[model samples]
Target: MDAAVSLLRRAEAAIPSGRGASALFAMLRPDDDPQSWRSTLNNDGAPYQIAVTDAGADASVRLIVDPFRLGRDEADRVGRNLAAFDRIAHRCSSAAAARCRRFMAALAPSFEEGCERRSGDIWLAALPGAAGVGIYVTARGRAPQIQCTRLIAAAGLDHHRAAIAAIHAYGAVEAYSIQGSRCDDLAINIYWKPRGGTPLPPAINFEPPALSPGSPPTALARAPLGAMTLCSTFAVLGSGRGSKIDLCNHCLGLDLAASLEILGRFCDLSPAFVRGAGDMLAGEDAEIAFLGVRVRPSGDRAYLYLKPAASACQSVPHLVEGATCR
Candidate 1:
C-alpha cells in the first residue's frame, strides 16, 4: 500500500463511527488516491485543491492549499478540520499518524465554498511543526470572512493584529448630491481648462446622477470629473453639512478614486492601520472645492494633499511623508 494511503486507513480506524463521524470519513475511502483525494461531501460549487508532505524532523507535516474551488463556508470548515487534526495528530502513535495523514492529505476542495461565498480568491500554505504551525494566506477581491480567533491562531496573534491595523489605516470616502428630483446620488461630469486662453467648456453642466446614498459605492463614484454642479440645498440641509463640503461632482469623483486606489495599495503592503481610518471630505456648499476625505496609510506614515484649484495646479499629489502617493 502507498504510505500515504496506509496512513489514512489507520487514522480512519481510530475515529468512532457515530454522531456525524461517518459523514466525516465518508469523503475518504480505501480506493481513494491519497494524492488526489479531496473532501467534497459538502461541496457547494467552489473549487479547492490541497497537497500534503512529510517535512521530516523539524516539521512533522506540510500542507499546501489552493482554495479556489470551495465556497467560503466550506473552506472555513476545512480549515477548522485541519486545526482539529493538528491537535489530534500530535498525540497519535506511529500507526495512527499514518491514518491521520490522509485526513488532511489533499483535501483542499473544502475551501471552494469560501471562494464562491465571498466572490474572492484564496491561497493558503501551512507547515505543522513540533512547536506550532506556520501558515501563509493570500486573498484578493473581498476580504476573508473567517472568525478572528481562527485567524489569530492560524496566522499568529501578532500578524493578525498587524493585518487589522493596516485595514484601519486605509479608510473610505464618499461624495454625492441631491438636485432637482434626484435624491442623494452619484454624479459624473467632465471639466476642461482653456488651452492657450481659448474658450473652455461650460463652467457647470449638470449630469444625471449615477448612484444613491443607500447604494453600494463604486470606484468611479469615489472620483468625479468634468463640469460640476453642487446643489446648495443638499449641502446646507444635509446632516453632514458642517463635516462635508461641496465640490464639482466630476472633480470630487476623480480625487476620491485616486485617494482610494493609493490607500488600497498602501494597505496591501502594510496592514498596520486596518481599523482606525474613516471617511473624510474637503469641498462644501455650491463651491467647487475639496470634499470630505478619509486619512489612510495611518499614523505619520502617509498623507494626502489638495491644493486650491489654480491655473497652475495641473495634478493632485498624494504623498507618504517624504514619498509621493503615486
Candidate 2:
C-alpha cells in the first residue's frame, strides 16, 4: 500500500486529474478493493502498474475499475463514472481531443439508448496514467458494427471506415482511451475461440500487422493463445492510426506458473515480483480469478491482469468456429 501510494504521488505531476477514473489510483490504496486491478508489465510486474509516457512525461496506468467491486450498485457507480467522463470530455477544446472524446462518449453503455451492454460489458481504465480515462465497450454481434460506424462518423474517423470494417471475430472490444480529452485513434480488440484445447496461432485466417511479435497464441510455445478463459487477440487496421496491429491476450487460467512463464516472454520483469503483486491480493477463500497477462503491440509490452475477486460477468460462451462450408 505504501509503495503504490508513493508511486502514485511521484507520478501525480505527470498524471492527469479530474475524471472518475482519476480517483482509481487513490481509491486503490486506502479504500481500494483489490478485486479490481491489473499491472501493465512495462517495468516491474507489480499488481499496480505505473509507466512514464513515451510522447511526454505523463505517468500512465493501464487498469480496469469495476464499479461493482467497490460495494456500490452498478448503476449508481457507472452513472457517476459516465457523467464524470462527459464533464471531463466537455472541456476538451482541441479538434483531435473533441473528436475522439465524442467518439468515446458515444460508446458509453445506455441500455435505454440501445447500447448493447451487459452488466460486465462496460469497463474503465487509466491509459498508462494519463489525465483522462479509457472507456472499454464490448459488443456481442454485428449490430454494434453499425453503431461503431455511426460513432466513426461522429468522431471524424470516417476515412478509416474500411480499416475498422476489416476486423472480424466472434466478439470485439472497442476501447477509446481519453486522456483528459486528448485522444488519438480507436483500438478495436478482436478475438476468436476454439472448441477445445489451446487455439493455434494460424487457425484464424489473416496476416499479422507489420512490426508485430508474430502471433500471440503461438508467441509462447507453452501457453498458446486460446479463448479458453478471459483471452482474445485484437485486430486493428492501420487505416485510422496509419497501420499498426497489436497481438494481446487478456486471460485467466487455472494455473499460475504457466501464466507467469507466458508473461516473462514479453518483458524482463522478475517473475517473483510479478507473482508477488498478484499474491498481495490472494486470500485463502478469495477467488483469485484476477490472474492473467496482457500484451501490447508496441514492443510487445506485457501486463499482469488481476482482479482479486470475480464479478458477475457472464462467461463468454466458448466459441466453436464452425467448419467453413468450402
Candidate 3:
C-alpha cells in the first residue's frame, strides 16, 4: 500500500469514523487499489479532500470523503471503513456525540428528498476533539427548495436558535462545520465561497473584494488568483451572541513557483519532497490544478486538493474531468 493509504488504514483501524471535514477516513478493502481513490480524495472541485496535518509518528490525516463508492457492497464497505474513524485521536462519548450522530441520521431523508442535485458537501475539520457534520443552508437556483437550516430544523438541531439565526445571517457562505466532541461547543464554520453545478476544472482567477480604505496589504485583506475564490472564506465559531470569528482568510490556488512564495510566508514547508503536501503527482508534468492554502492568525494552512491527471484518457471520469451535477 502507498504510505498515505497505509497511514489512512492505520488510522482507520486505530478507531472508527471521523472529525468534521478532514478526519473522515476509512479502511480500504483488499481488492481496492488505493491509488485509484487518491484522485477522488484530493479533488477540490468535488469538495472531497484528504488533508494531512503535522508530520512523522504524530502526523494525523483527515479527509471529508465522498460516499459514492462504485461497487454493490460499497455501502457496507463504506460503513465498515467509516467506522474506523470514530476514535482516531480522540473519542466522543458524551451525549453530544450521540446527539450529533442522531442529527446526521435525521438529515439523510431530507438530503434524498431534495429536488435539487448539489454535489455532496461532506465537511471534515482537523481542529482536534471536534467531530460533526455540516451542510450548505442557502437557497440556490430557480425556486430552490432544500436548504441546510431547514434540514437542521427538521432534524431538531434548530433548538440552538442561535445557530439557526447565525445561518440566516451568513446565507452566502459555502460550507459549515459543527464541533461535536466538545459537548458544549456549538460552533459552526461557514466556507465563504460557493461551488455548484457539477465539477468545473479550476481556472486561475483571483477576484478580491474591495477592501476598506485603511485595509492592509495581507491575505486577509486581499486575495490571490486561481485560488478557491476571491470572496473571503470564513469560519463562524459560535452562534448569535456567542458567535465570533474563529479563522478567516482567502484560500489561494497557485502554480508551483507561486505556491512556494506564499507557502514560506505561512509555514516552513521545504520546497522539495515535503511529506503530507497536497500536491500528489506521479509524473513530473502533472500540472497542479490547485495548490490550496489558507492564511490565518494561528498560521497558514494548506490542502493538496485536486487529483493528478490520469493517462491521457478522453475522460478519466473524475470530477475535474468534467461531469454534470447528478
Candidate 4:
C-alpha cells in the first residue's frame, strides 16, 4: 500500500510541467484472493481503469502518461523513454541489492538520453527486492557532454558527502541542506555548472562565514557557481514506518525519493505514508527564498563567497564584527 502511494505521488511530481498532462494508474492483484491484495488508482476525474492477474500480490504498478501534454515530437520521445522504464519497473519492484546496481547501470543509457535532451531533471524510483528503494537523478549542464554517475548514500547527510564532492568536482554553485520539522529527514539539493564554465553572475570579492562548533545555520556556503545549504531536520523516522510526506511539492518529491532510496539501501521496507497534498512537477525552479543573505557571489580563489544569515550572525557573535551581506 505504501509503495503504491509513493509511486502515485512520484508520478504526479515526476514531470516538469503539469499543463495538459494526465496519468493512468493501474495495479494487479490475484482474483482468487482479492482481499489479500488490493490496489487504488486515484485519478482526478479522468476515466481510466485496468486489471491484470499476476503474482505481484505484494504490489504491481503501471503508469500511462498522456502524450498530448508534451506535443507530438516531444510526446513521442517521452513515450519511448517511459516505455523502456515500464519494461523494467516490475523487475525493479523485486530485485535484490546486486540486481539493483545492475538495473541502475543498465538504465544509465536511457537517463543519459534524458539528460541530453535536458529540458528538465529526470528522476525515477523503484523497490529492489522488496527490501530497499533506488532513485536515479540525472541532470545535464553540470558535466556537459559527459555522463557521470555518483553513488549517493542516505546515511552521509551531515558531512554533505556526495553533494560536496559533486560541487567541487563539477563546479556546482547551488547546493543546500534542509532540516525540516514536518519530516525527520535531510534534503541536500544542488545545482551545477559544467566543467570549465564561467561564473554566471560575473564576480565579486567576499569570504564564507565560519560556522560555530555546535550546530550550523540554515545557509551553508556560497560559491562562484552559486550558494549551498546543508539543512538539518529535527524529525527522525526510525525504521521508516509511518513516515509522512508532508512537505512542499518540489521538496516533497525530493525528500520522499531520497529517503526511500536510502531506506531501500538498508533493505528496510517499513510502512510509510505521504500525508500532504501536492502537484505534478512544475517547470519552474524550486523556491529557495528561505536562505536569505546566506548566498553571495565572488570571483575569488574559491570562485564564490558566503555569509551568515541575520539569525546566524546574531547567534554567533563573532560573525557580526566583520560580516557584510553586500
Candidate 5:
C-alpha cells in the first residue's frame, strides 16, 4: 500500500501540467467508489475522504484532501487535465457521455445562434474530477469567462447555481450527472435561461425510436460513417476476354428495369454497367433486355458472397473481380 501510494505520486508528477487532474482526482479517492466519491465531493464542495483498513493488523488510516485552497498553478493543471478527460470519456459508451453528445448535437444550431448573438466562444470540457461535465463561454478579450461545472460537489450548490445562471444568461444548455458510491441514484440537471433573458433557440428535436416494453433502451446510434450499406444484387458484364471494370457495390444491384428507372431519375446511365445477360437479351429480343444481376453482401461485419451469374457459363469472361471475392 505504501509502495502503491508512492507509485501514484510518481505517476502524478510525470503527467503534463494540464493532463493530470483526472489522475490526481482518482488518487485522492483511491479505493473509493468512483461514482460515489465524485458525487459526494461535488455535492459537499469538500475534500475527498480516503479510508484505508487492515483487518489483520487492526490498523486504518483516514485522510481528507481539502479542495478550497489549491495553488493557482495546480488548479490550472487540474483544469486542463479535466478537459482532456472529458474528450476521452466521450469515446466511451457511458450513459452520461451519450446524453451529453445527444444534447450537444441537438442544440448545435442554437449554440451557433447564441455564439453569434453574444459574440462569444462556447467551449465544452469533461470534468471527470467533478464527476460530471462543464461548459464555458467567453467573449473575445473577456477575462474570467462565464463557466458552469455541473455534477460538482453537492456542498457547492451556491457555486453550482451561480455557474448555471451564468451559462443560461449566455444562452447555453447543459446536462450532467452525479452518482457516487454512497448514492445509487443518478442525479441529472439541465439548465437554461428564462424568457426575459437572452433565450436559447428551441432545442432541435431528434427523438430516437422507443424500445418495446420488455426491452432495454436501444444503444445510442453509432457515428455516421461507422456503417455502410452494400447492394445484394449485381450482374457481371464482359466478353470472353479480360474487359475488367469495377463498380461500387451499391451499383451492382440494379436490374435492367431498375437501371432504366435510375437512368430516368439521373438522366445518365453511363455510371451503370450493362449486365452480361443484357447482351444476350440485346441480341435475342431488342424490346426485352435481360440484365444479369449479381447478388452478394459486403461489409465489415460479415462474409457474404454470391456466385457471379456469369460463373455458371464456363465460356464467360472475367469482367469485374473483387479482391475479396478471389
Candidate 6:
C-alpha cells in the first residue's frame, strides 16, 4: 500500500496542473473491490466524488488519472468508460497486445473529452505477472493523441522506458516504439491520432532470416518519405503470417463503415481482412501481417495470407516468401 501511494504521488507530482484540473486514483487487490485511494491536489479544492466504482477479478491493481474537473453528467460517463477499461485490462492480461488495443479503440468514445485546456484521462493496470497495459490521451494542437502500450516490468518504472517516453512526449511526438526486453521477444507499440483522424499505426520492421528483435505483431513499416506517427501498440508473439481485427468499427459514435475503412488504411490491408479478423486474433502465436504490404504466405486460406493491397507499400522485404506459411 505504501508503495502504491509513492507511485501515485510521483505520477501526480510529475503531471502538469492547471486551475480547474484534477486527478483520481483507484487501486484493487486480487478479488478485492476497487477503492478511492489517493488524489492529486485539486486546483479549486472542489470536493471530490467517486468517479469509477467498478473493478474486475483479473485486474489486481488499477490507477486512473482524470486531469480535468468533471460535471455530474461527465463524471457518470467517465465512470462507465472506466468500466470498459476494467474489462480490457482483464482481457488483455493473457491475450495478444493487438487484441487489447482493439478493445481500447472500440471504447474511444467513452473516454473523457479533450478541449483546448485539458486532455483526456489516463488509465493503467498491472496484472500479477510482469505484464501490464496503459492508455493515455492527449489534447495537443487541433488533434488529440491516444497511445497504448503493453508493459513488461523488470523491476520498477526504470524498466518501462516507453511509458516514460510517452509521458514526456505527451504533447510532442505522434508515436514511437520501445524495446521491452532484449532476451524475450517483447516490444511496445505506440500509435498517434489527430483528434478525429483515424488511428495512426505503429511501425513494423521485419528483417530477413531473423525478424527485427522486439517487433510488434501488427504494425505498419515507417516510410522514409512520409513519417507516420504511432497511435497505439499491442503485444504480439511469433513470426508466421497472422490475422488482424479492428474493434473501432464495432464501437459507437463513429460510422462503422468509415472506422473499418480507416483501420484498413492504417495497416494497408483491405476492409474484408479487418472485418474477417475481428476477435479472431485474440489467440496466442497469431502472426499478423498485411499480405502484399508485409508478408504473403503461399496459400488460399484467409488465415494463411492477410488481404493483399496493390497500392499497399511493401514495408519490408519478405525473406521466405511464404515458405513458412501454415
The model with the greatest lDDT is 2
For residues 1-326, write the lDDT of model 1, one tens digit per residue: 11112222322232211122122222221221223322221111111111111111110222222232232365455555454444434433444333333323232223554434332222222222222121222222223333223333332233224333222223111111111111122111111121233332232222222222343335444433332222211121122211111223224334544544433432231222211111112222011122222222231122222222222111211100122110
How does each model score on TM-score? 0.20, 0.50, 0.48, 0.19, 0.20, 0.26
- Model 2 TM-score (2 dp): 0.50
Question: All models: lDDT?
Answer: 0.25, 0.36, 0.35, 0.26, 0.26, 0.29
lDDT for each residue of candidate 3 in 211-299, tens digit (9 for 90 to 100): 22553435433553223431222222233222222112114334445544444444545333243343333233233433334443444
Across residues 46-163, which tens digit of lDDT does each residue of candidate 4 receive?
1111110011112122222211112135445455434434433544233233333343343233434443432222233222222222223333334421322332333233333433
Candidate 5 per-residue C-alpha lDDT over 86-164 given as tens digits, one digit per residue, 9 for 90 to 100: 5444433376454444333332223333323321122333322234343322222222123233222221334234433
**Candidate 2, number of clashes:** 10
How well does model 3 score by local distance difference test?
0.35
Regions of candidate 1 where Cα sits further than 4 Å from its true position: 1-63, 66-80, 83-131, 136-138, 143-163, 171-326
Q: Top TM-score: which candidate number?
A: 2
**Residue-level error in angstroms, candidate 1, position 181:** 62
RMSD of each: 24.3, 10.3, 9.6, 22.5, 28.0, 19.5
The candidates, ranked best first by TM-score, are 2, 3, 6, 1, 5, 4
Q: Is candidate 3 or candidate 6 better by TM-score?
A: 3
Worst 10 residues of 4 by lDDT: 299-308
Error of 4 at 47 (Å): 38
* Model 6 Cα shift for residue 19 (angstroms): 47
Q: Name the candidate, 1 or 5, with the larger TM-score value.
A: 1
